[model samples]
Target: MPNLTEPKLISGNANRTLAKAVARRMSMHRGMSVGLVDARVERFNDQEIFVEVFENVRGEDMFIIQPTSNPANDNLMELLIISDALRRSSAARITAVIPYFGYARQDRRTKARTPITAKLVANMIAEAGIERILTMDLHAAQIQGFFDIPVDNLYASPIFSLDIMHNFRSQMDNLMIVSPDVGGVARARELAQRIGAPLAIVDKRREKPGEIAEMTVIGDVTGKTCIIVDDICDTAGTLCKAAEVLIGAGATEVHSYITHGVLSGPAVGRIQNSVMKSLVITDSIEATDAVKATSNIRIVPTAPMFAQAILNIWNGTSVSSLFDHETLTPIYEGMYSAA
Candidate 1:
């Protein structure tokens, strides 16, 4: 029950833009004053990472905002090393605010001789002396069990739904929520229910990663504007294919709102050339130059949402406030209505 008044923010090389945005949003808090820690995370010629904190963090609440996104190994190691440094520096509490848990997709072992890397990552973070974990839209919910410490899994539904409501108000009647696969039905249904839109499913099977079997639309999408909801969009193969399938199913328009845009490999090219109308992703991961140049892909900031969550955690407020449609809807709208 450690109180987090005047929390200290820290960042790694991974997604520094997002870390800065979170700090900026937290600065808007009237009750508490927070600032980014002065720390240097550099490397040597042999690619070894080094960390040094310039300020005193003794007995102060610390939150490391690092998303293990691209260059997953390097980012992951950096998070672990930074947390170790903070713990040794005697920070009162260290919470890893990971926007994108890169190893989350491998939460379970699907085949013989395979390892559950997600659980391993969780163990590493805990062993690094991170007292708590704050992440968003985990690929699998049960991954929470892998951690022995307090874990807060924040939902981005409010942000995404409010955005949808603002931008697609005119098409609310004609809009439909679609799950790319059966596993994502719950996430999609939540958004659909929140926005009062009908739900559809793309019954898809993938023989292997990035290779999809035949996909069929479970609900009639003819003449409807379809919106696909999912957690991660890596490489954009499944997303582009799902869009093609929806278009072939007579969908008038197709757009995707994914939480973590792990746009590795040819994701940018695929997204740009795909039949989808638009691909909206959260700024959980830093946008690449290619992603910035793409006209069809847009990024929504998650800093405001994380800033609120971090504040609540410190104030002993229930994190469930983030899911309250009546309360959070207006806040999200005000934050991103113009965008």
Candidate 2:
């Protein structure tokens, strides 16, 4: 049997900073000398991935923290290789802690002969012998159904809610939560309900990938500070255009709270020139140098939440309770104080 009480954590090259932060928080919360396992992920001259685990993992509960972000193929392959290595070493109960699930946008085939890459990725992970999965704020909730293993999909809403309350408490009455598209109305509505604000939607027509043809506001955002919410911001074309439409409709200020900041291509440039007041994103994907240099871009740490979730899973506690902000606020505050 595996030692379920003391879980071993291993991280790949993907999002090392976030992984370290999560490990630190786990050590603080559990009051143990929890640390990341020693590992080396290297590549050959021909671009073949090689992963070596230094410590013995036999009969230990193993968790690999690797988000499939930039260089998605490389990071994902690294994760699979690491899992196979751990499984071959007789590690018990392997869980892949993927903070940001890449290729999640292709949950279904919208066009003829298109492939559902999300489902394919799920199958790949399962075939690699991973017994459990832990991810946050998937592009579509339905993607969870693709996985056969036990998956604990965590949410970023609680963290965003706390930050909004702390920073925008005085402006709550005049605040309006806006969804960048109809698909995201549910997410925006939940956040709006938490802050006691009205919800608005940006009705947009996508002519093709990475391009927005038309955009119109569904509800009144006139003279109110609008906060656009969404799961991912890749290339940022839609978010920037939505901010323009909101500003034109008399919104006092426009801000965005996105879960994954896949700021590829000209995303940073667009945000720099857009009417948006600020763009707040979680540390699900590691930020690039351009993102760091952008004046209006801010990153909220997600380590505390991931830390708590890992602890809960190890202790066999209720994971859903972490979604309730009212219940988890004190716990987070305590963790901060301990740090």
Candidate 3:
């Protein structure tokens, strides 16, 4: 821990509930204080952004809590302005604590003359005087290399693995971990290994973004309960289609475990009509109204894990242990309530 005495926690409008949760977790220990700036960000008639931070925080160890989720442009600009304010006010060190790092999918330029927006976001953060970054479950692992500052890219797999072990333990023999796409095979494999289940993959060809033309099942899903795993679920296109494919392939049940639920467009409706029995998502990003209304969707909190990571980082301890399987068993156990 880096002298918790002088650290001042501040939050923007991105995810106040998560920020408060993190603050409460930090407050569990003595001698640390937290604050929030009146960061009311609004745009002019011409679409220009204006940000104002109402608190003064000079020469303090500042942590700005903001997630670049939906309305990414506004949230991102708010974060940048807050960072600039802290820097101008002479904060000793500034850390951008983003539970969900957006624009992560744009890590590479697949087409000619296209932009790598992920690197651009990193540049903006660095330019805003962010000394460090704390984020979770980046869409692409390579995005971490885009940042010059110390970037801690956390994983939500441990959180999900624990939840599955507790709720689906009795059905362990029938369970199969599925990668919704070939790109996420490693993530699916990790979860499969943790729960001692078989692994499968969904081979799909994309004619365009958010559209899956066709899917082929790579492994046996017949008469088995399948759990589709992925880094993020945007439109829920792949998940719904994959679930349908699994069901058609003799799967008895279909469920999804995704790290980030960037549920945009018709995702909620898609999941509602799909064959999926349930869709489990972590609260890396706040749940939208549509998500709340969808009966098939469930949300698990990541506050405990994130808070533990923050504690370990501040204490100058090993973060590797946080990623270890043994350390995460409790998270899933907690998911199962007392009967």
**Top candidate when judged by TM-score against the true structure:** 2
TM-score between candidate 1 and the true structure = 0.96
Candidate 1 CA-lDDT value: 0.89
Of the two candidates 2 and 3, the one with more favorable lDDT, higher being better, is: 2
Against the hidden reference, what TM-scores do the models get? 0.96, 0.97, 0.92
Per-residue alpha-carbon lDDT of model 1 for 1-339, expressed as tens digits? Answer: 656457789999999898888888788764555567999999999999999999998998889999999899999999999999989999989999999998898999898999999999999999999998999999999999999999899888888888898889889999999999999999999999988999999888778877888898899999999999999998999899999999999999999999998898999999989999999999999999899889999898888778888888777788778887676755455654542
Supply the global lDDT for candidate 2.
0.91
> Which pairs clash inside model 1?
none
The runs of at least 3 residues in candidate 2 whose Cα sits more than 4 Å from the true structure, single-residue gaps closed, are 1-5, 334-339
In order of lDDT, best first, we have 2, 1, 3
Model 1's C-alpha root-mean-square deviation from the true structure amounts to 1.9
**Ten contiguous residues with the weakest lDDT in model 1:** 330-339
Give me the candidate number with maximum lDDT: 2
Summarize candidate 3's per-residue lDDT along 200-244 as a digit string, tens digits.
999999998866788999998999999999988988888899999
